[model samples]
Target chain A: MTATNSFFHPAFFYIALAMVLPFIRGRFYYWRWLLLVPSVVAIISVISMDHGTYMVIPWLGHDLILGRVDRLSIVFAHVFAIMSLIGFIYGFHLKEKAHHIAATLYVGGSFGCVFAGDYLTLFVFWELMSMASVFLVWLRRNPVSTRAGFRYFFFHAVGGLLLLAGLLYRYYAVGTFAFTAVDPSNAQFYDYLIMAGFCVNTATIPLHAWLSDAYPEATVAGAVFMCAFTTKTAVYVLARGFSGFYILAVMGTLTAIYGVLYASIENNARRILSYHIISQVGYMVAGIGIGTLMTVNGAVAHAYAHILYKGLLFMGAGCLLYAAGTANLDKLGGLVGRIPLVMIGYMVGAVSISGMPFFNGFISKTMTIAGAAHAHYTWLAIGLEVAAVGTFLSVGIKLPYFAFWSKPIYKGELRPIPINMYIAMGIASGLCILQGVYPNVLYNLLPYPAEAMKYHPYTAWHLVQSFMLLSFTGLGFYFMRTVIAPHPGRNLDFDVLYRLIVNTFAFIICKPLAWMDNIWTNVYRIFGMRGLLGLGTGTKWFDLKGIDLVVDGTAYTVGDIGGVSAKAQTGRLQDYLAWTVIVALCVFAIVWWL
Target chain B: MRNWLGDWLEKTRIKHAKIWMGVFITIMAALVIFNLFIRPHHVEFGYDAYCGFWAVFGLGVCLLMVFVMKKIVQPFLAGPEDSYDSNE
Candidate 1:
């Protein structure tokens, strides 16, 4: 047998680039293009691979498939690779080799997970993703970011453990570690545990605080990468495995409302974006749980469109942070004059996410809401529409309006944004529009391509509804501007709850353990050591007095036998000749008798 | 081209800001009028078939979100931004 194109898994390209990056030490300035190579290569690789498992390894009586190439994984990996390429280009001006490496590994880890056909491989890559993202957060190298990184890591640690526990128990019960779809009706505790793990990454409410906590604190470029991967990858897994889980459906809707509400109150621009990620991901999550073919297809298609536009949004936010030295909406205003190109780029993202007609989000988000409504999930659909309204209010209008057009224009020194950053944002914006103008580009790649094709977003009603909806949302923002204007403070989230739990755990576990240790020390010092010494002495005595005598007797007997043999061997030559003669005569007599 | 656009945004747009606002209002009014002529492909819920249902819903939801979140929830959740840092 000969090797085929099976080695062309995109994960391999990303990880290999991560490994080779550190060696390109000083010339990183000119050689920065290397950062773009793996992603470009991955895009090509994802496109060329046919619909079959490509890289398979035999492991402990199961086939650990590394490349489960099908419509589902293909759609995700396709977008992931493209986003990674864009992320690198957006971060191109940074001289930090570590950032690129971490971002690459993070991207690689996501790809590994998307293609992993078994639980073990998925967990490994999932963990790799978690740690690499922590580094992305930590690369900012400030006290706040350090604290945020630790929190991010700690949350993921809990999530990874949940995934590990779930997968292990599942393997024990089912005798297989395959990462296939779960029948929601037959889902066990372990399945929910796995979903809980995915939920943490997906920014599902109550498990979602870590995202808004961490993303805003990450390095500018890192946030761009962070936004694109962590939650959406989790969405992929949920759509793959836990589709139709009612819990996800409820939680997703709540998250949609929850995220936008918090975003509406957020002072930090990046944090606002972070919260809106929850809102957008909520749409996908709800679609997954709705479980109809159209809804599922809607979820997958939304993820594809989301990666491009959201990455652009992050890049725009990053460019501001990179040049203006602040992402706080309170500090930002009238930046359109300083960075008009960025404003334009960001508006494209804003409009796209707001579900404006002919933008990518319209192509995907409406489908999910419509699918829910059509499926008679009236409340969920209504909840989703409310989220849509909030989305446009906060992100589409508020973030940009404050950052670029608000009164009292910032008089701070502005640095020139790297040309590459603009170029990358441009690329992502183009893709968002391209996918929007030609909806078929994204629709045909969905899991249910036929349903996707059958669903028309360009109907007269949809267009009218979208324009009116978005426009009124603008009007609402205008009316409520002073009420919703971002104030300079932190609004509490589940991170506060997490901190409470951790503090309570410390108090509950530590004081008792310390008391126990004190008691144990007192008990040991007084009696335990003496008891141990007495037992040791008895064993020593028994070994010396009881067991040694028999051994000594055997030695004496052996010595006596040696002495007798020595005495007998004193005149050896004559005795030896006599013994030989006797033996020979005995043999001859026996032979004659025979 | 970039500088020209930047100058326009800084100088010209702010001067004609009211015009832009008026333009936006015009677009909104036109949407409600158009909703009178075009019917929904399918109505899935109450009032969805009526003109201006979306407009009402959109405005209402946005207002409710701000009032609830900003007016109600923010007081409870808001803190000095460095609450965590100080706690740390």
Candidate 2:
């Protein structure tokens, strides 16, 4: 129970701090084994019997309470730790200290945020997480990345401001900053404000546009880090703060549907995966929105499962980017033959995201669907199911088809991927399979007190349904294969409207304003009317022709000033005394005049 | 047996391939109605009959969607790898 005896405690502080050690003082080993420390501690913590929140240090301004290591936080923390390790391994050969530092800080910040018992402590670390992660996106060293990182920061900054405002209001009202339940139905204004802050990071609907736009632009490794934290932490916040906010269900369902549609049209392999991040989070948000213990548990479970597979998928795409110099699906055909390992890794990740049987996504997604069905929100469940199908279509079928099987646009130029990259992906692929096959590994960590989800991967009906669906889809693909010419091109969506149309509108408005100013200046010149300038410069205004002449005449006379100057110029000590006496007499005389 | 099963699968796959979207849409619509009307009222739609029904229906819908996308939709939407980028 003591922090010293418990290895699973925020012992992550040293480990996370150590993750930054490599980047702080650039040495070779910083990037290698330092990544594993957080993961090791996270695993130990998950298995440990620590309950109730405990601060890392009670006295410091930075009080990180490793409070309440229950089922939910454990699940999230566990996955985050594993993801940090996998991501580190994936970028093992990356020599940049910035990349390592950003990853460590980002993951470490998330860890601190999740374990904090108080909202004040969480906000401090939450902003840290945002500040730390932006460097990852900027590491791409491209204009696109620079712009994307700014947009990413802009949204998060707004979210942080909203959260702080809410916290301030709550602190004023309740006189306590500890994380506690607040009912949305009769919520203090602060609660709604805080929830809005949480939603920005959660990528809830209208606010979600930044995630898809920004994530794909990060450096290959950067995207992996982006995929791992942020939104999932918001899901954590949702679980903790606004557990049963019903509107979240609507938001989640719409996000799921929207993600799939946009993903369907996307050409970049990484972009497709990024879209699915929103889609999967939608399921989690919806589950949390349902408010049932089982459903909220499902959201927690899904967030845990999603981090792993989504990270894996991003890693696979990164591997493709590393080897072939492109992740554009059109240009990346028959890569399966070249980088079979990466292809396999991508397939595992794709299957997992697709909710294929014996995959991590299947176990997690079914729980959400079941929770909805249990709640008798059949329509929401149906939307989830439809979105699930869309998920498979956009990622499972489309990614593999274009990347591995489609006719090679890069037919002769394929290259082998790096060994470290393959090994990293291999580890992730194994974990995905293992978690899918035996989901109890993941299920045990849910915030719920005990394990309740029983996944039946094989029933007669289940197999039949799965087979019928897969086989028919396969049939459809082959029949229409001739018609579907696989090629890569940009398909504009909501982000494009902002980037192109809205920007153009700003330009147009500014141009007219500029022209109007020009016209106004011309009119002034035409009339010879420079009123302000004329007044100041003695053209024909108050300074030269009006009140200034009278005011100056009344204020002073040159003769009065000359008399004082002559007295001050006498240098002899006696003369100086006499001059001083005269000045003193003048001072008394002026006082009498006043 | 493997060959026979494979042959049957190929035959079935090809025959059902073109209309998979239509079939999927129909099943999804039916499931929606089932969940909305029959299940909500606690009508005996069978023992948790629709419980995993969506999964089955989803599989069909998913496969058909990919098919329609890859075959019909993609051709119009997808262009040459760098077709739009004239300079490239």
**Which residues of candidate 1, in runs, are more than 4 Å off?**
A1-7, A26-28, A521-594
| Top-DockQ structure, candidate number | 1
Q: Which 10-residue window of candidate 2 chain A scores lowest in summed lDDT?
A: A555-564
What fraction of the native interface does candidate 2 get right in terms of contacts? 0.20
The interface RMSD values of the models, given in order, are 13.3, 14.9
Give the TM-score, chain B only, in order for the candidates: 0.88, 0.37
Q: Candidate 2 on A10-63: residue-level lDDT in tens?
A: 435534565556445444655466566666666666567466556555532334
- Cand. 1: chain B TM-score: 0.88
Tens-digit per-residue lDDT, A188-267, candidate 1: 99998999999999989899988998999999999999999989899999988999987888899999999998999999
Q: Worst lDDT window (10 residues) for model 2 chain B?
A: B79-88
